[model samples]
Target: MIREKSKERLVISEFFKPFLRILQIFSCYSPVPASSTAYKMYSVVEVTLLIFVPCFLKTVDVLQSFTELDEALATLLIYVTFFIYTLKSISLITQKDDVRKLVRCLDLDIFQPRNTRQRNFIKGQILTSKGILTLFTAGGCFTCTLLDLQPLLINRQERNGPINFWYPVVNTTKSPAYEIAYAYESIVSITHAFTHCVLDAINIICMAFIIGQLHSIEDTLINLRSYAEKEVNIKGEPNTTEKIHVQMNILLIECVSKHRALRRFANDLNKIYTNNFFLILANCMLALAFLMYKMSKAATLDFTFIFMIFYFGTMMTLVFMCNWYGNEIIYKSGNLHTAAYSMDWPGTPISFQKNLLFTIIHLQVPIKLYALNFFLLCLESYISVVKTSWSYFVMLTTVSNN
Candidate 1:
């Protein structure tokens, strides 16, 4: 009976279970109901020991060898990447209430489907989100495994472990010490990979949901007249024409309210993530520039070369997907105005016309996600960042050759 009751109450969040499980293992976050006091403390300890401590040690190691620009640069890349991941994890924990609200909003009545068609539409989005998450998580884990396994495949005398992080009071070069360090780094590397994949997946899935909602709204708006007529017919209300107009007004009000809710959701999303996105963009561009420089200098297709190839691909995908979904949001929201205009509004009551006219006017501006208010996240920005990274790579190669 308990199991049956639980199954009956399951909501759309079942689609996100994989992502949440990954996050739980990484100690980044879990849903509010599951975030008990012990889990919170474990999250703190795991993040500090596995992420923050290594980051600090790496920073110290880099500073001690600051004059060796090339060596320091190589280590700096790892440090910067880990720093960004740690910051994102900490930020999510600190803003748990806002994130909880956002997640809870997903299960709200307004977001639920009203008919079979709507249910199918949302299910499609859920499937797409899951597919993307699976591919991304697999790719990420593969890349991290390749990087970590390089040490095992190489000669013992030449191995430097998975990462170049410094450990205090621990000689990472000796036998037992090296084995312990290797295991620790492997765990940390996998955690880092999963954290990036799952956190980014959360944001991507949220945008997917918003896109689904927008399409649902468009369909509702386009079919407003038919829906109104159906309701009027079923109710068998007197003054059928008057009842249709009344139904249209009620439906339009609901659409408008949902539109407003979506805007708020987007706003909250930006407020929490704008700065992080900006930092991530900057980090990707910088890392891509350095990776290109190194790849260009490689004389053979060695492990370093292959590793960089995978790393480079991961960064490119991250940037591209962020912009791709942001662009989708903009495009879908902009079409709302057109959807509103096509609702067969000619014979509707004056009040319905007025409400729809206001809706069309408001939606005209469209929606956009910005990175630190500097630039919009879209294909154009992605192209610009790639071009800029290429220029930097060119300059570095020229300088090195001279």
Candidate 2:
């Protein structure tokens, strides 16, 4: 038991590593379940689960769904998960914890963080604030504006019904609840995406800072070596070599620090897209809502939007997910317990071919998932154009058949 406690203490020294271990234990194998309270990182792991549980249980019409520990419990879990993460945030601000200081100690002080960290920090702020805004937006303006979602909501029971493969349109006359829910989910997703992106940016920034610092230290060492070479005539070759060897341990320390950063960066990115792919999930939900609405009419405009959403969403999801592989490998190489930059895609081993798809995901994984909110604006462009364009000019909304 003493040895076990010491082992636990050693592992818990890292900030987020403990939380990751908990996750591994929770999902992998363990008897009687582990304490959910045993977390250190402010990850959305809990939030993601919460978002799913309550909704899933509510749909199944089971009261015990709230109590059960299964994947089917969606909404309840979603609530619980978010609640936990929020609790962590609150704790971080309120506690006497020293994790941040510990991280500072562990961090390489040689390099400087990239702009990515600031950007990510900003994004996190936006998510925290804008997600709240999104929540309100999903609730609608509430100006006593009554909307009929029936025109847009799709009936899921239809068999062999024409489904749109392009852009999706939803009627706001009937399926208001689902639409509202979907919109709210979008807010949750975007917020989460922003959070993850911000975290990545922070990691990058920290890494850049560390690496920069290390570079300077390396330069100093090189200068010292040069000086030592010049002094070899006086100190003798053996004495000069001895002095160089004396600084060897410091060099080794710097090298280790550099290598670990690279490896951690890669591993973190490889898993990034999947961990925070909620934005795509939100988009997919929006597409579903649009599909729900399009089913009531034979119009192609609605179907086009559906197709566009699916096509774009799927492609984007695939791109984001697959990009992680290259990122992981590159970072791994950079942090390879040695000082070397990674330069290959699907690199080093042929076996990584299977992981090539993931590498692509890593490569394209943007630090800010919502940096292209303009595209989101474009998505909504269909709502206005399709509804009003026919009376104005050459109706492009009527051009394609979904």
Using lDDT, give the best candidate's number: 1
Summarize candidate 2's per-residue lDDT along 1-402 as a digit string, tens digits: 001111111111133343324333323111222325544232235444433332343344334344532322222323332333333333322321232433443443322222233224323432343343333333332210111222234454331112111112543224564455445444444443333222223223333333333333333333433333444444444654455443333333444454345445434432332322333333333433333333223355564344433333332332233223223333433333122222122122333333433333332322212112322212333333233322321222233222
1-402: candidate 1 lDDT, tens digit per residue: 001111233266667777777777767666765667888788788878877887787778777766754665677666667777777777776676776677777787677665566666777876887787778777888888987988777665775878767777888888898888888888889878878778888777877888888887888889888887776766666747787888888888888888888888888888877876786688788888888887887656888778888888888888888888889999999999999998889977788888989989988877788899777988998998899999988887777777
lDDT of all the models against the reference? 0.78, 0.32
TM-score for each of the candidates: 0.91, 0.30
Q: Quote the lDDT for 48 in model 2.
A: 42
Superposed Cα deviation of residue 342, candidate 2 (Å):
15
Q: Model 2 residue 370 lDDT?
A: 18
Runs off by more than 4 Å, candidate 1:
1-10, 33-37
Off by over 4 Å in 2: 1-54, 57-249, 257-402
Best by TM-score: 1
Q: Backbone clash tally for model 1?
A: 0
The CA lDDT at 143 in model 1 is 85
